[model samples]
Target chain A: MDIINNLVKNLGDGIAAGIYGALGQGLAADILIMVIAAIAVFAVASGGFAGLTYAERKIVARIQDRVGPNQAGPYGILQPIADAVKLFTKEDTTPAEADFWVYNLAPIIVAVFATLTFTVVPFAPGVVGTNLNIGAFYIIAIGSASTIAILMAGWGSNNKYSLLGAFRTVAQLVGYEVPMLLNMLPVIMLTGSMSLVDIIERQAGWNGSWGLPFIVILPLSGLAFLISGIAEAGRSPFDLLEAESEIVAGFHVEYSGMKFGLIMMGEYMNALGVAVMFSVLFLGGYAGPILPPYLWLVLKAFGVFLVLMWLRGTLPRVRIDQLLNMNWKFFVPLSVVNLILVMILGKVFVSDPALFKANGGILIQPLAQALIMGASSFVLLMIALAIVTRRVRKDRMAEARILLQRRETNQQIAASVH
Target chain B: MRTDYAFIGVTLVVACALIGVVPILNYLIAPQTPNKSKRETYECGMETVGDTWVQFRAQYYLFALIFVLFDVGGVLLFPFAVAYNSVNLWGVIVVSLFVLTLLASLGYAIKKGALNWE
Candidate 1:
């Protein structure tokens, strides 16, 4: 047990030294590996886009009790490839009235930002493309680039629907992002690190393990993060960005052929990015028993993505007003309250001497903290439920009173006629 | 750690190149026989109408403006949260005050109906 654990722990250092030795101890080899890894991340993310569409169609079809995309290959596994071919062969259409430069530049910007997020995702120890100190924050910053890209597409397309779609997209993103960022605080507070790899590592080991994932401890924050994340991805029930019935595909309405394909690719890539981040931040990244770390991360991300797809299939799209209302009135307030609750709980019960390292660093006592936060969150949830129920009952009473008054008025009029 | 950014730079270039190259490749191999009709801006097959550019709602701008304030505040809180384990109770109290100020702004925004969609 000791030998295997030591080997597993030193895996990253071993790989680094091995590469250094093989490359004759120079910076060139590191750069070469970095470049290769960067390209690989791009390739994987793009491929993830293809896989996601297939998965989405299949899942939604099963939900609707129908077979989907079964023509192209066995069970439609090759449908994405078929899609790529069709998109490639279709005529690239550019509107005569469109702004030439901005129209041409928007798709590229979207694709680039979508791909940029992959740099910070750690699939396993020694497996990340680059582990920046501000990995979590960096993801958020990179995400903002998509907003600019959407605006460019909307304005450049020279279409009313596209412009309106862009406007809604901006509102949805801005509304949800505050709560999303706030929801992340508990994770950061508990872990005391911003680098994703470090966060994962802090959740490592038997005694110090935070129950294998932060989500287990902070369920309320986890729920808030998931919902906000879905909004951020522009997925249903918050997919007002491309609400086809209202705006005819939103910001990308003007794009066709390969350009349209690029826009779709960016969207799917963003979804995959969110899934990966959620896995890393809450599900303990790549930590698991028995299975390889990278595989574990992949499985967890896939599981999260599946849940997202399930929500997409089951829920109807919300109107733009309702969408904004949900975010501002419900999610934002809940997230903030959750953050304060977490902070208080951490301060009161989580600052024990045993939880601190001899070197003044803190080790999360997962069991203790989980016991505290879980109970607090449940109490918080119950309070929210109670408030909602009370408001509902009050509304029902007012409605009943109005109905009774109308009935009495009708009875008096009948009596007067008799 | 700083040098790791070079990887990101390379990744950006590669991403741009991939997006740029694929469409150009499609243009190269795909038959492009565009007539005046094909080149026209696609509406649901109606004749070209007035200018395509139209005014949009300012409600989006309101949310974005508020987003700017909150996002910056969130960024400021990042350091505090990252160092929370080591920070003393006084430090926690001070940061809590900072967060409370942010919450106060949010409450003000709510009271002003800044979040009202209609």
Candidate 2:
């Protein structure tokens, strides 16, 4: 019984130790363990991608009042496998004038970077592929690098639509990234550490119960992060990068077969990455009772992904200008202010030792602090919403006035001519 | 820390190898019969007109510049955030001032119509 529980709890560590013991604890054993862990992460991410696609299709189909794929092996369970076989067998195409090397290298870059991000994501306690001190920063850096691969695909394609899509990529991805990074600051501040494991541990209440997640204290930043995360993943309403109606499949316009398959894999992998990160950052990570830690983490991540799919089904894609405007004009400013507010609140309520003593209990301190911060942030959100509503109303009224003036002038000109 | 990074490096190599091998295998298995019409750039069945690498608007460069500015600022602020608990009120003041400076730059950019889509 003891061995079984230990095996269930420390599965990854047990495997590493088993390999080490088998290989006499040498450097080769270390290298082999790392390689195996990497492969495991890749498997998990790709499997998540496959399942995400099927879930997205079914959810979106139901949203549109239709039955989704049901033919392939019991309610379309094998649909992704069938799709994979078809993509593998299809003929790959490269445009005659395309840059041969960069065009071919782009998909590999996308897949590699997407897979690399899973390195720092802690699945369960001590189950991370790596425990980098700058885990959060590493994720941001790797994510930004994928932008280069996208640009390479677009420019190397040598097609007009691809170039347009590439330009939109710069405008949208770079624009929303500012807000995303800014919003992350508050969570880092509250935790006082950049290691994702530390951040998760910081959220635990007394006795390791599921404590108040960061979302409760910093709702504004959490909301901003979600919006920016969706944009970062290039999903709907912010998917100006590959708005199919506008740019005919965007950056990968010229890619065919497995190359296109690789790009799609990168995209779905990114969506899964974002969902997992959101869970780790704001959903108390793998912290739950009764169920195993990794299972809790997976459940939370799937919940977030379901929300993403819901939005993808429900929302219409915004125009490029509107997308950029929302990022810069709305989210960026809101996040910056929220960061400052959170900084002050953290210093006063969270970081102060006196407050902890005064509160007289571990749970009370966090609860009180959360209440204060949450209330303040809710007020800030209300004010910002009111201001935005006023500005939008004013703009609409002014545009209506201009149209009325134009119509009246046309009527006057017609009367004069008569 | 070093061992962790070594693991990351190995994972990176493995990820590259895993992704790279698929296309190679596909190349071996998948048929490749290229024709002139098939290899041409797709333009919705219309003849290609004008160069694809035409001059893009300068607005893209402007956005990139602003992004770089904020991105660097965020990187600089990260250390302060991590050290926030250990630092004093003076530290808070200094960080606040730094943020104020960033906000000032954003205001200047807004005033100059740098963010205007038109």
Candidate achieving the largest lDDT: 2
- Candidate 1 residues lying further than 4 Å off, grouped into runs, are A1-27, A209-211, A351-366, A388-418
Docking class of 1: medium
- Candidate 2: TM-score of chain A is 0.91
Relative to the true structure, how large is the alpha-carbon lDDT of every model?
A: 0.82, 0.85
Minimum summed lDDT over a 10-residue window in model 1 chain A is located at A355-364
DockQ of each: 0.61, 0.65
Per-residue CA lDDT of model 1 for B1-118, tens digit only, reads: 6787888998998788778998898888678887888777666677768876755667777788878888898999899889877775556667778778877887898899988878
TM-score for all predictions? 0.89, 0.94
Chain A fold similarity by TM-score, each prediction: 0.87, 0.91
**What digit string (tens of lDDT, one per residue) describes model 1 on residues A1-418?**
4345344336645665777788876778776666667778998898789888998999989997889899998999999999999999988888777899999889889889999999999887777878898888898889878988998998898877787788888888877889889988888888888899987886674245433577777888888898898899889888999998888889898898888999889888988898999998888888888777777888999999999999988999998877887777777777777887787677766545754542233445657667778878878977876886787689679989999999999999999999
What TM-score does chain B alone reach in each candidate, compared with the true chain B? Answer: 0.87, 0.94
Q: B102, model 1: CA deviation in Å? A: 2.0
